[model samples]
Target: VLDRQGLDAFMRQIRSKFESSLIQDEKNERFPGYARRRWGGALKTLLAAIDKV
Candidate 1:
């Protein structure tokens, strides 16, 4: 049970982590495409789930 502010903070944290992962994927050479695709899907699903709520 998160209040509105808590929810916003949580979303910001998640977004930051995902953004960091994507940035790292761009910089690293190994499996960059795969990692980016997986994280991209997770980010999309997260946004969709939050929108539903």
Candidate 2:
């Protein structure tokens, strides 16, 4: 039980970090045009799904 709890906490931390990174990438305008536009919408969708999980 303890191991499972620890793993769950670790997974949550990783998810949080991933969400933060995605947000930062969306805000960064220095990326090439294709990446900037394409990834922004995709990442937002992915983040929403992650939140649901």
lDDT of each: 0.71, 0.57
What would you estimate as the lDDT of candidate 2?
A: 0.57
- Candidate 1 per-residue lDDT, tens place, 1-53, comes to 66556666776876777778867877888776666576667768667766766
Cα misplacement distance, residue 18 of candidate 1 (Å): 2.8
* Local accuracy of candidate 2 as per-residue lDDT tens digits, 1-53: 23555555655655566556656676776763544345555656555655655
- What TM-score would each prediction reach against the true structure? 0.53, 0.42
| Collision count for each candidate, in order | 0, 0
Candidate 2 segments whose C-alpha is farther than 4 A from its true place: 27-53
CA RMSD, predictions in order: 2.7, 7.3
**Candidate of highest TM-score:** 1
Leading candidate by lDDT: 1
Backbone clashes (count) for model 1: 0
Model 1's C-alpha root-mean-square deviation from the true structure amounts to 2.7
**Residue 35 of model 2: what lDDT?**
45
